[model samples]
Target: MTKKLFWEDPYLSTFTSSVISVEENENWPGKFLVVLDETGFYPEGGGQPWDEGNIGDGYVSYVFIKDGVIYHVVDQDPGKGAIQKCRIDWDRRFDFMQQHLGQHILSSVFEKHHNAETVGFHLGTETVTIDLTMDSISDEELQKVELEANNQIYKNLKVQSLFPSVEGLKELPLRKQPTTDEDIRIIEIKDYDYSPCGGTHPAYTGEVGMVKVRKWEKVRGNIRIEFACGLRALKDFIWKNQQINSISALLSLKDVEAYEGTERIYRELRDLNKKYNQQSRLLLEYQVKEYHREAEEYQGISLVSLVFEDKDMKQLQTLAAALNQYPNTVALLAAKGDKAQVVFTRSKDLSLDISKLFKEVIGLIDGKGGGNPITAQGGGDNVANLQGLMDAAVIKLKHEYVK
Candidate 1:
């Protein structure tokens, strides 16, 4: 077992300890060794990240635990029985302290006000999460918890850690009973809260600065609460406000007026789309009128077909439907936009083999398309070959349907 200096003094970032043992473990590559220390270095466990810095001028790449022993994985192995100086990155260590302490206060508030238990906890790089036993906690309820937690922070309550015997714990009004009998380290926040936790925390609640609930959601019959503390919370607020200001400027509206401006723009776009559809329908009707007059009659069978420069699939289908209304008539329409779109339809008593014709015509243009027999559709990217496509459709009709 290693003496956790973080529990003794959370502010201690540098210490001197003798390396009692240094032996490489086979399970780890590059470097692996455990140190029997007198002081320093918070191990990576209990959901909080390990302290990062140097041990006796050697870089500590990873710090972890195995069977309650803290193992510092350094880039260069230090000789056994050597006295090494250790230093932790204070900024990162302090951030973990603030977040860990903030969680203690927030969890206490949930237990006090709603009888909820802190079932899970995770300390992340940007935020900290605490999972409560409650099935659902509304936004309003979460706000109440936030308000109370920050209020306690403002009060600057004294926080103390004490090891009490199993019999001694019976006298203290604990929030939850400890599962283990091994020296229970109870963290008491004045009159506010008392719980058994081995994780590092600040000496006073005020050191946590401000607690803000960033967001929350329900997970596995519990409410998972995400929050930030101290500088983290402050930074999040500043970034979010900057985003809102940018949105207001882009929309050309005040902060309060942005929503209404967006709604108005959406409505105007919908109305413009309706007008555009009506104009397209009128244009298609005129094209159909011209086709009726120009169609060629063969044995009482009128054939009106043309390949137009660059038109979409929808326009080609509309033209085919309009020309097919004439009895004993057949129309084959092909339009090449970024790609080619073709539609063919025949009136009663006229049958056109469109699938075979598309394979023959489109294949010459190095494209692929196919459709049904009486009415066939195909397309490709050979826009420059519109004339060829029109001539081919006419030839196929002459050979297959005109007879």
Candidate 2:
């Protein structure tokens, strides 16, 4: 069994130890697994990531444990030597320590105040999240938990890691029971909290700096709280402050007034859009009247077949519906811009199956569409042939059905 030097001195950055064993990692090519007599590198376990740094000449990329043995995945094979130097990346290690401890304090607060249990935890690169037993929590209630968690951090209570005997475990009020009975490791947060954990943590709660719940959402009948601690929380604050300042300057409002100012601007834009749509509808009605007047009459059927430039398919459908309101009228419309489009419709008084005629014409433009006998619409990339497609529809109607 390898000695866990990390448990002895979590802050130990550099140490010398013998390279006890070396083996090629079967799963990772060009990588070697090196085991030392003692190590400060924390293996990936307990919802905490593995510590990465240097082992002799090799860069340690990942660390893991298999059947009670810790393995360090190295980029290069640290040669056969009696003693090799190992160094822990302190920044990465301490950041994880802060987040891990912050989770303990926050979880304890949730349990104490709301009678909620922490069902899951994930320490991500950008944020840490804890899944709680409760399905929902009010903002005011969450604010209380956040304030209490930060209060514990400010108190700077002593954090202790204990290896208590199985019999001795009955005396402490642990937040949760350990999964294993043998060799149980417990983390006690002074008088605040106690729980079984193998993850590394700082000596004092103050090292966590602060605990801020960024947001929360319900997931699988539980509430998942996304949070940040210490440096991560500080970085989050800086980014949000910059955004607020930029918005305030742009709107000529104070930081506190930015929300209201943005809301007002959104309302004005929505109202303007409503007015523009009204005016556009009025213009389309007038254009429809002009097109109806110019329609050609063949055998008592008014054929409103026309091609427009840069017109949207929605507008074409609206025009077809309007023209179909007239007696014994058929609207065959096409538009050309980035693509060719066709819309065909007939009045309720007529029994012309325009869908069949629509199919024959839209195929000229390599388009696909379907509709009932009264209306059909489609578009294709053959914009240059859109007018020809419209004319084909008129001929198909006059020859096949209008007769």
TM-score, one value per model: 0.72, 0.86
What root-mean-square deviation over C-alphas does model 2 reach? 3.1
Question: How do the residues 140-222 of candidate 2 rate in per-residue lDDT, one tens digit apiece?
Answer: 99999999999999999999889988778999999999998676999999999999998999999999999989999999999
lDDT of 1 by residue, 143-202 (tens): 999999999999999999989887788988898777677857898999988888777788
Q: CA lDDT, every prediction? A: 0.82, 0.90
Candidate number with greatest TM-score: 2
Best by lDDT: 2
Estimate the TM-score for candidate 1. 0.72
